[model samples]
Target: MKNLKKYAKAIILLTVIILLVCFSFYKISKSRSSQFFGGLTSHVNTEEKIIALTFDDAPTEYTNEILEILDDKNVKATFFVVGKNFEKYPLEGEAIIENGHEIGNHSYSHQRCIFKSQTFIESEIEKTNTLIHDHGYKGEITFRPPNGKKLFGLPYYLNKNNIKTIMWDVEPDTYVSGDADAIVKYTVENTKPGSIILLHPLNGTAGEADREALPKIIDELKAGGYSFVTVSQLLKYEN
Candidate 1:
């Protein structure tokens, strides 16, 4: 009976330790700033009134609409496009380039990168990079993992290849759901100097609020004397 009780306690302690490790990994995978390896930029550390406006999962049919709003505001933004979507919407991808915006790779299949194999990770990024190059994006190709989730394999591959992972400090669409006004308010309120603002204006109906809020967000930020820059340009201001 004594031995059984000791064994039970040992099992409980083991289970608790396992749970803690799992929980810690979960939090780290979802973290915007922390990673197992490589340089991750959630927001550049600077006091300049300049910010990078990044739209993820792009080159969908809504690309033109988003681009139009940015053009109207005379703002330059970065689009992290998925490989398959970019292929399907070649003209839209071309349009993004034509409009003088920067493009980054957002993976080929847009899958969650945690616990994935290194080969799989490399394939996803390389496939997307190839497509981006084929589409004539000449600027530095940065990367943003799908769903902003990454762990050992993804970060290791990125670090090995010297690819900087671009994350965002401000994500209003995610927190505010489909409320345009709320997105605008949250973004405008949370934005600071050197903030990397993320939006998902290409996500079909779910993204309508973001698309609607884009112009307002830009106008509000510009009103506060914040100038927009691309991800590469924003990196230059990092201290």
Candidate 2:
């Protein structure tokens, strides 16, 4: 009986340790600034009233509308596009380039990057890079993980290839989804100098509020004396 009780306590302790490790990894995977390897930029450090507007999962049907709004505002934002989507919507991808915006790889399959094989991570990023090149995007290609998820393999590959993981400091769409007013308020309130603002305005009907909030966010920021630039341009201001 004594031996059985000891074994039961050992098992419980082991289970608790395992759970704690898993929870830690979960938090690290989604962290915008922390990673296992490579350089990650959530936001640049500068006092200039300049920010980068980044949109994830692009080349959707709503791309043109978002581009039109940016054009009207005369803003150059960054688009992190998926490989399959870019392949499917070549014209939309081209339109982004034609309008002179920066492109970043958001992976080919758009799968979570945590606990994935190195080969898988390599393929996802390289394939997307090829697609972006084929589409004639002639700027420095940064990368943003799908769902902002990353772990050992993804960061290692990025570090090996000398690519920076682009993340955002201001993500209003996450806190106030589908509420244009709330998104605008949240973004305008949270933005600071050198802030990297993230949005998902090209995600079909689900992103309508983000789309509506985009122009307003731009106007509000510009009114507050913030000039918009692409992610690469924003990196130049890193201090």
Candidate 3:
């Protein structure tokens, strides 16, 4: 009876340790700027006074409003549009291209790429790329995982195929209350040479606040003498 009790305690301790190790690996694997394999870049190191403005999600109902602002400022942004959104707003996506902006793949269903199989990762990416192509966008389509969480499968696929993972340095929505003035202020103040600014002004569900922020952010960046480029264009400064 004594030996059985000792063995049972040992088994429990070993199980607890295994669980802790798995949890730690889970967190690290899902990190935005860290991965067990492949290089993860959140910011590019460069001295050139150039920046990239990337918008994620749909070409929502506010697409025309944001487009007008970019047109007025003479700025071109990269839209990391989702496949489902593109299907819903085919016209909007096409207009984005016609206006000389860049497009990227944001996955089909905006699913998190953590602990997923290679087949699932491939489908999420490849299907989105196909949608991007259907929208008349003919440039390099980089990938930005939903919510910036990726793991072994995502990195392995992107690295093997030489696809760049685009992330951001300054996120105004994350700091401000998604107001136009606040968004613009955060962007103008935090921007540096070769910064990547992320904005989520695409989804109509976020209301007019985000839509209003689009032009203000653009005008502010322009006033600061920051030249806006697409994600691929920004990649030219990569070391």
- On TM-score, the candidate that comes out on top is 1
Give per-residue CA lDDT, model 2, range 1-239, as digits (tens).
99999999999999999999999999999999889997899999999999999999989999999999999999999999999999999999999999999999999989998888998999999999998998788888999999999979999999999998999999987788899999999999999999999999999877899998999999999999999998889889988
Backbone N/Cα/C clashes per model: 0, 0, 0
Which runs in model 1 stand beyond 4 Å of their true positions?
none
Preferred candidate (TM-score higher): 2 or 3: 2
Superposed Cα deviation of residue 35, candidate 3 (Å):
2.2
Error of 3 at 118 (Å): 1.8
The parts of candidate 3 lying over 4 Å away from their true place are 1-16, 19-23
The TM-scores of all predictions, comma-separated, are 0.98, 0.97, 0.88
1-239 per-residue lDDT for model 1 (tens digits):
99999999999999999999999999999999889998899999998999999999989999989988999999999999999899899999999998999999999999999889998899999999998888887898999999999989999999999999999999986689899999999999999999999998988998999988999999999999999999999999988
lDDT for each of the candidates? Answer: 0.93, 0.93, 0.81
Q: What does candidate 3's lDDT look like per residue over 1-239, in tens digits?
A: 99999999999999999999989878876565777657766677888888998888867777887888788888888888888888888899889999999888788889898889999999999988988886677888788888887777888998887777877888877788547787778878998988888887776656456677777777766777778887778888976
